[model samples]
Target: MERGLTGRYEVTRTAEEAVRAFVPNPLPPEPPLDLSGERQRLLEQALLACGRLDGVSALLPDPDLFLYAYVRREAVLSSQIEGTQSSLSDLLLFELDEAPGVPFDDVVEVSNYVAALEHGMNRLREGFPISNRLLREMHEKLLARGRGVDKLPGEFRQTQNWIGGTRPGNAHYVPPPPADLADCMASLERFIHSDPKPFPDLINAALTHVQFETIHPFLDGNGRVGRLLIALMLHDAKVLRQPLLYLSLYFKQHRAEYYRLLDRVRQEGDWEAWLEFFLEGVTQTAGGAVETAHRLLALFQEDRNRLQDLGRSAANTLRIFNALCSRPIATIRDLEATTGVSYPTASKAIETLSELGIVRELTGRQRDRVYAYDRYLALLNEGTEPL
Candidate 1:
């Protein structure tokens, strides 16, 4: 609708020079959003896809098994957008604590993402509201160790920050000045907790995402935390039963368009365009998650059937295989502890699976041998290649 510039810009001074920093208005865009016709159809499709994704838990023995791997996949992709080179295998290998020569800084950032995500979901599960306090908590965990440790992890920035250039004067975008950050975020919190919200939860989420990004609340880890906020918002609103919908892969795929729409919302008041893109991403990502679940279920069934064809040793072999499904990468010691089998039994079972081409040894060592559920990791690793 080209209502106008979404917010006012103020000339703020950086160390080098002066720049125009943006202060975005709160949620529920003025003159309202135009969700008629095509936008409405997109919204319905997105909600239906979300419903299907929520029901995918029915296909799994335990949803946490999928979530355990899926969340790490998300962490990898999200950190990649921030220029991290960590892959899914790197993350799994790190979690296994056998990371000898891995990319420590990149993998550390990705690992912190997993921890931050888990913290938010756990708090939500414990009936905590989605508020600034929760955002700060997640940010604290996000920068707990690696790269951005000195940037004040849990607190909002008290210094002006700019994006995409060498200095604020030449930066492509400048967020609100430090003095206005608190008011901007407080307005965002009110919109989140508002009863009888002005828009549907899906639309509300899309709007909140843009607002949060524009605010650039944290000095570092703003991009990662903003992505996490989407999953957190939808789950808290009861829009999804689980935190299964992630847009990191989608945003990473259509990154140029994602940035363009964010700019349009700020420059021309084009909320409709951004809503359509965000809604399409929700539908596409949710559908992909459900499809992945089905494929994993089928893979387990097919492999188990193959094991059943064997004779007396099938019982114990199947036991270790079940444990492998939960932790696709593990040491024989890990498999032994998880399945309560002897070291010899665990070794023998893994050897049997290796003969069947189901498991591959990661480290060719006499001791501390690690095995991978080859096909399973391949399935989860799709679209997670680091940029």
Candidate 2:
């Protein structure tokens, strides 16, 4: 299925020199994707994994408790792919306004990702269509703070942009010129809202992801925005009850291969190869999420069982413990406000959990100590090691 140079390139003049910027052909690549045999098997496996992930949502006693931490984990991993060194703990620490040694720019970028994602999910839940407008809104939140604040947050690039090079003249891949960006994105919008989609939702997501990367819509944060689109698309199509199937970990694991496949789709019309890779990512990531959910559930139960052994203090400790399950990292004041316990009770409960090794103090200060649910954070920290 070599469609020979997937899109036409036009020579454009950059301030440095003349460069050939590529304008990609609209969605539904020509000679349609070959979905027979192995591809079909992969698709089925991905769908089955998704079904299991959807089932996981219903099984959790409080899915939001899991989502609260899981989404932050995703935020860390996703921003890590974009060269941010912000770890999950850095984000949690930043959220509490106690960021000391953490990189402010990196943590702020990651925090913005969390906010952007929350905004997108909320809008989707409010029955908003996944269109260019929503993408802009999410993009606005994404670059609203820190380093990317100057990158034209919510708007498409009005100037040429390139990827991986010193300048546009020597860039690895130059996206379409500014003049063509609007039309390119509009075409993408139509495909998103197409009445009879040419491909199934998952397949469409894979296709849309590649197209978004190719288009390179925004001046900055294109990579993060494109990845966010995948979760939004899956949730919109009802593939998952929650926005849980994040491919950042998988993509981060297979970084080179992921980029190579995206290039192959444009260089050679090898949609099947990319589709296979995307499906594997879907299945692997979804399955990993389900396993994480189960582990969290078991850990919750095991810790709750331990709380029962607290004797007379178990009743009050349980309230604080439940609150920690959602926040994982909290100040005594936060614990008091959330659990509605007095400051003394909150302090005593956290001290008890610290003795039990269920929670550990993040800051050594005796006055404004912050506690971390150590085991819980460790579970979510898996595979999020900085690159």
Candidate 3:
């Protein structure tokens, strides 16, 4: 299965230095993927996991509550891979207009990711094609604020870029130079449109992700954007009702191996190895998401049942509890606004929940107190212990 070099490299001169910039061949590599035996088994497992995840979403009373929090968790983890130090809690705190203890720039990066992802998924749901234009739109939102603002946010890079080194001289890999971008990107666009032949959705996504990484279209946020493309493709193909299958956690956990496999595809024509890894990631990530959704659903039901024991306070207590299910952490003011109840009423309800050990107060203060849904947050915070 070793077909070799996958694509040709161009000898380009940048800043009085010569470098070999890789221009990857388009999708549906010659001699097709070897989907026999183990590879076929992995593909089947991934499809089954995705099917199970889809079932979970369909059965949920409100999938958006899970989607809302899950997407933000992905944003935090995806940006973490790009060296951002923000955590999922930090993102929630930031969304609530509270200061996240992390650096302002780091939180902004994660926040932008959330916005960018939402934009892409919304556009796709509206019947927009996943082409270069949509990617540009996503890139615009991704670097809309903070550190990446100066990195030519929406447009493809017009200058040479390198990865893993100070300059092209010692860079780990140099992407296609500026002059070759148009042809390179156009070929990529055709592949995305499934010009000649169409691969299955999961296989198409795996191929597209690697090609985008090699293309490294934007000046910055290539890695983040490439990862986003996976969710977008899956959703577009109707593989999942919600954008719930994120592989960033798996990729981040296996960081070194992930990069190595990507390189292996380019250097050696080892698509089978990378495909195997990707399938495993998809299966593991999808199964994990299904488990988390079920656990969260069960926890919410159990806690709601427990709240029913609040007797006279049960009616008002249930209202606040529902708000916490959506926002896991809330201040009295948050519950008040969300539940449309008065301040004193919200406070008493929170006090009742706290007494019942349903909600835990985080800040030890007499005023401006904040409360967390305790076990609910614990379930979401699993595997998200920050980098």
C-alpha RMSD values across all candidates: 1.0, 0.9, 1.3
Cα lDDT for residue 79, candidate 1: 97
TM-score of 1: 0.98
Error of 1 at 297 (Å): 0.5
Span of 10 residues, lowest total lDDT, candidate 3: 191-200
The models' CA-based lDDT, in order, is 0.92, 0.92, 0.90
Instruction: Give the Å error, residue 253, model 3.
Output: 0.8
Clashes per candidate, residues 3 or more apart or on different chains: 0, 0, 0
lDDT score for residue 186 of model 3: 86
- Model 2: per-residue Cα lDDT over 279-311, one tens digit each: 999999999999999999999999999889778
Query: Which one is best on lDDT?
Result: 1
lDDT of 3 by residue, 1-387 (tens): 787998899998888999999988877788788899998899999999999999999999998999988998899899999999998778887887878889999999999999999999989878999989899999999999999999999999999999999999789999998988888888887887875447778998999999999999899999999999999999988888788999999999999999999899998888889999999999999999999999998898988898887678789989989999999888999899999989998999998888889899777889888788889877877887677
**Tens digit of per-residue lDDT, candidate 1, span 1-387:** 787899999997788687999999777798888889999999999999999998986557988899998999999999999999988888888898878345799999999999999999999999989999999999999999989899999999999998999889999999999999999999999998888888889998899999999999999999899999999999888888778889999999999999999999999999999999999999999999999999999999999999997798899899999999999999999999999999999899999999999999988888898899999999999998877
What's the lDDT for residue 270 in model 1?
A: 93
The whole-model C-alpha lDDT of candidate 1 against the native structure comes to 0.92
Please, what is the TM-score per model?
0.98, 0.99, 0.97
